[model samples]
Target chain A: MKKYVKKAFIDTLPIMAGYIVLGIGFGVVLKSAGYGLGWALAMSVFIFAGSMQYAMVGLLTGGASFLTIAITTFLVNARHLFYGMSMIEKYKDAGARKPYLIFALSDETYSLVCNSDEGRDYYLLVSMFDQIYWIIGSVIGSLLGAIIPFNTEGIDFSLTALFIVVYTDQWLNTKNHVSAIIGIVASVVCLVLCGSDKFLIPAMISIMVLLFVMKKFCIKEEE
Target chain B: MNWYAVIAIAISALVTVSLRAVPFVAFRGNKQLPAFVDYLGKTLPYAIMGMLVIFCLKSTSFALTRGWAPQLIAGALVVVTYVWKKSTILSIVAGTACYMVLIQIVFR
Candidate 1:
């Protein structure tokens, strides 16, 4: 068990850095919005999702309806659906730990757990340690945000920067850019027509339709 | 936080977990996921990621003078930095820093 714990810790060192920093950003965002340590802890503990939690701050601040929040959460996290599909085989025998593993399967954890051939305990340890780093970082950030008096007027653009970097990574790694282009164009169109307040659902629906259409028409396009 | 916000947070966590658990519950063995589902698993991420990029930018105010510059320039910096460095952290920090300066100082 010690060996696996150490192995998980060593393997997830990079994720630790990333999660803690992003967690700090999230905490500051929460603090700026008048939430303090308790709220940050609740969010990082419960949601445990990076991007969606950032969006959640906006959703709550905007006073969006319950239905809107649910749909937006689904849309923001739609990628996890794909992540789970790939992990079904690896996590098959996770057994009692499976539920927490599934629940804690953040994007960073998925990237680590999916590629690993290490057994259940190692995966669980990695997930747990990653979450710990995240929670710790958020608490620190919340405390710091409360005490610091510096101007952080536009720090929320970290979310935007995150999305752009991920998008670019996917774009460079993928062969065909058709679906990516479609996603951008459809979303931009929807945002213009429907407005930012009402754009997400429409953007998601159109992206799915466009992807389906592309699949049907280009049945064997480059794999 | 109000009960409304608390419930909203619960819904977010619930929905997020449900998405992760879907494949496990549905495909409880070597049972093959449908071809379309498999296709989606392969293709949807890039598309959804692309959509998310645009989603983040949807609030860019077009009415303001130089409103587009911060988003545009910062987004370009992210693309360039990521391509150059291939580092997610570096790319985000660089882009975000550029954005902070553009909005807080340059275009303020």
Candidate 2:
């Protein structure tokens, strides 16, 4: 057990590096939205979804309906459904740790879990450690955001920058641009037609439609 | 409002956890995964990341948003820094710091 814990901690350090910073970003955004430390703690513990939590700040502040919140959360986390496909066999013997293992499978955690060949305990430890780092970072960020006395007028731009960094990396790694183009074109058209307030649902619908229609084209690249 | 926030968190958590469990609950015993699901798994991420980029940038004062010059400059700097360095933390920090400076003093 001690051995697995040590290995898990070492394996998850890289994720800790990113999650803490990103969690801090999320916490800061939540704080700026007038939420307190309890809100930050609750979100990190319960929601645990990184980018979705960031997006949630906007929704919460804008007074979005629960239906909107549900759809948005589902759409943003659709990737997890596929992630579950791969983990089915890996986690078949997870036993009681299985549920929490599935719940804690963030992108960073998944990146590590999929590669490691350890038993359930190792996976559980890694997942637990990752969440702990995230919680720590978020709470610290919330505190800092409340007390910091700086002109944070354009701090929100960091969110955009963070997404761009990930987008750029994805662009570089993937040979398929068709899906990427479809996503952008559909969202832009929806934004133009529906406006920012109502564009997300339309954009989501169009993305799904376009991707399904162009499925063969995307599949061809993979093969 | 507090109730709303708590409910939002609970719903988001529920939806996310359910998605994570779909395969475990629905499929078992050597079942072949559908081609469409596999394809979605492959393509949706790139697609969603594309959509997310637009969402994040929409109406931001940066990235040529309403001709916000400083924001556009900082946005470009972030891309360049990430492309060159491949360091996410560095790129975000650099771009954010540059935006603050531009808005605070340089473009002020």
Candidate 3:
């Protein structure tokens, strides 16, 4: 248990590094939108989805409809269905810590657990620690945004940078490049065909099918 | 939208958490999953990662997308750097630097 906690802490460092910058950006943006530190902290605690949190700024400022927000969130986070499906077994044994694991399934947390050394109870540790870092960064960012008045023109790019880093890491660690290449190709094709508004769903569907097909065909051939 | 966002965030968290915790609560003392679900579970990450990689590229800035030429160069550079040697920071820096040089300097 002690080692589990330590490993979780260590594994969470990269996520914390990413979250501080991303969360700070979120804080500044939320503050600029007229939400106070309390709101920022609350959002960080409750919402915890980085990209969606950023999008929340637009929603808050614009007064969008509840239905609209719900639909958008469902779409934006649709991939979680797949993620949750994968973790069914991993979470099956979590016992008392199970609920918190589900609550804390942000992209960073998921990535950490997914890529972690298998069979270790590091998942629970990483989840808790990652949530802590995110919450801290957001609260700090909101407070600082209120106090400091720097130009925030390009802070949004930090989110993109974070994603780039994570994707690069996955690409590097993956021994088989087939899935990576398929993702790149399918997504680009979908973006061109569907446009930005509706690209993600179709692209994801295509890649999912392609990967399944590859698995079936290649595994059979190997055998 | 503010009120709605607040509510959505609250509800989404609950729903997601519940979904994640269901298996744990259901199988607290168990280590095994049903065969088909187990198989799907194993393959789920690659699918998720595939979706995420696409998601990231969509959000990359227009500054990197002036023409097919620069995007192609930068994309190839990223793939090569990534495949030859796996370094997250290096790939990002190389990709970004390639974009900057191609779009801001050379193409300009």
Candidate 4:
């Protein structure tokens, strides 16, 4: 147990850096949006999706309907469906930790756990630590928002940098560029047509449909 | 908390959790996933990562010379640093530090 916990902690160090900064950014955004510490705590603990939580600040400020927020949340996080699918076999025997495993499966957690050969306890510990780092960073950010005097204008770019780094690594490792190209083209088109605010769902749906169709065509050609 | 905030948070939590648990629940039992579904499971990670990169840049406009420059430069630095060093932490931290410096100092 100690070994698993230690391994989990060591593995999560990178995510700790990313989540803390990103969480602080979210907390600062929430503070500037007139939300107090309570809201940051609640969102960090509950919604927990990093990017969606950031977007939720906009929805909360804009007075978006509950339905709109829910739908958008689903769209933003639809990729988790893929993550979960990939992990089904791994988590099949996770037993009591299964629910929390699913609950805390954020993007960073997914990336860590998807390739992990560790035990269930290790995955659980990693997930728990990641959330703790996020919560701590958010609380600190909320507290610091009123105290800090420095400009935090572009700090949010950390999240973008994190994604870019991950994408670069994935690109370098992958043999197939077809799916990557499809995702980029579909998303760019949707972004141009539906606008940034409404492009996510369209891009996701198009990618899914296109991949399915392409798979079918390839299978038929092979037959 | 306000009622609207509570409701939105609850809905977001519900939706996010449901999405995460869908595969486990839907694929309950020993039933195997279809070939295409398996292919997607393997392929989607790379594609989704790509999509997320674009999503992160969605707010920046290329038309505004100043708006996109910092992001593009910082992003390139991130990719190059990662490719060169193969250290995720250093690459992300360096790129983010570069962006923070550019926007707070250089671009200002």
Predicted structure with the largest lDDT when compared to the true one: 4
The C-alpha stretches of model 3 lying farther than 4 A from their native spots are A4-10, A118-120, A146-178, A212-215, A218-223, B1-8, B15-36, B60-108
Task: Compute the lDDT of residue A112 as modeled in candidate 4.
Answer: 68
Listed models, DockQ each: 0.54, 0.49, 0.33, 0.66
* Docking level of model 4: medium
| Native contacts recovered by model 3 | 0.32
Model 4: fraction of the reference interface contacts it also forms: 0.79
Top-TM-score candidate index: 4
* Model 3 global lDDT (CA atoms, 0 to 1): 0.66
Model 1 lDDT on a 0 to 1 scale: 0.79
| Model 2 per-residue lDDT at B62 | 39
- Per-residue accuracy of model 2 over B27-90 as CA lDDT, tens digit each: 6554655776555656766666666667766664433444477667888999999999988778
Which residue pairs of candidate 3 clash? A63-B1
Worst 10 residues of 3 chain A by lDDT: A151-160
Return the TM-score for each candidate structure.
0.73, 0.67, 0.75, 0.86
Candidate 2, DockQ to 2 decimals? 0.49
CAPRI-style quality class for the chain A–B interface of candidate 3: acceptable
Q: Write the per-residue lDDT of candidate 3 for residues A1-223, one digit (tens) a residue.
A: 6778876775565566568767887887888888878888888787778877887788768887667766666666666666676777666667777667777888767766776564435777787788888888788788887454643333333334445555566655555556556767788889878886688778878877876677754223221
Shift of residue A148 alpha carbon in model 1, Å: 2.2
Lowest summed-lDDT stretch of 10 residues in model 3 chain B? B59-68
In order of DockQ, best first, we have 4, 1, 2, 3
Q: Which regions of candidate 2 deviate over 4 angstroms?
A: A1-39, A49-98, A105-130, A141-145, A152-159, B1-12, B27-30, B61-71
